[model samples]
Target: MPGGRPPSLRTVASWILTHPDALPEKERLKLKSVLAGCPELDALAEHVRSFGQMLTQLRGERLPEWIAAVRADDLPILHTFANGLERDLAAVTAGLSLPWSSGIVEDHVNRIKMIKRQIYGRAGFKLLRKRVLLAS
Candidate 1:
């Protein structure tokens, strides 16, 4: 026998095999070091290492009701929810055309200062609004 020993490999195997949920990172590393004293954990270690990837793959699955609901397009009776969806879609798809999409109105607002200065600040809000609408 060796002059010094931690324990028989069987002892380390039993310690890990019996406490599946006790494997915190620190404890897990310690257990791994001890397990290196034997080959018993090879299969268990491989499976444990793959557990997170397995869970991630499972999580990628769409829930049945979620798929059905998306297909149905049914939503609560709230205009805000629909409006929010519209805004999100607008932000994503640059191809979306709406009253707000064109920059003509924005350009008109930015030009208002120069237009007002040219007019010596005599233009009122109504005149400015009319000029902006016509410019756009």
Candidate 2:
């Protein structure tokens, strides 16, 4: 916890969920003791684990129930996440259920943005279009 470069909250959560055993022995022991000492933390961990399982398994049908449970649990951060997910429920469900991903499309968009930045104030539309086509 006290280091020049400490791990992020997301990193710590990921470590706890995906690779706790890979953590250093002292850190792992501390994590285990902390979790064992807190019932709320244990329950939250179980909730997150179940959500992760649903995501990995592409069980979009379970999302509504999961959101409800999160809301009922009154975890402020998770409740905010649930609310955002609810706002984009359709897109979230599609992402969970579909085998396809938008990663390639997003990559292309990012490349285009990079190219635009590189050519900003130095190029016209036609030249930029040509560069984009050629690059692709």
- Count of clashing pairs, candidate 1: 0
What lDDT tens digits, residue by residue, belong to model 2 across residues 3-111? Answer: 4455566755765686455688876765666567666766677678778877788887888998888887857888898889999899998887778888999999999
Per-candidate Cα lDDT values, in order, are 0.48, 0.78
Off by over 4 Å in 1: 1-26, 56-136
What tens-digit string does per-residue lDDT give for candidate 1 at 1-136?
2344455667655555544465566556656666575454553444333333333344313333332333344333323433554465434223332234458776766798666666666767888777757765
Clashing residue pair totals per candidate (backbone < 3 A):
0, 0
Highest TM-score model number: 2
* C-alpha lDDT of candidate 2 relative to the true structure: 0.78
Quote each prediction's TM-score.
0.23, 0.75
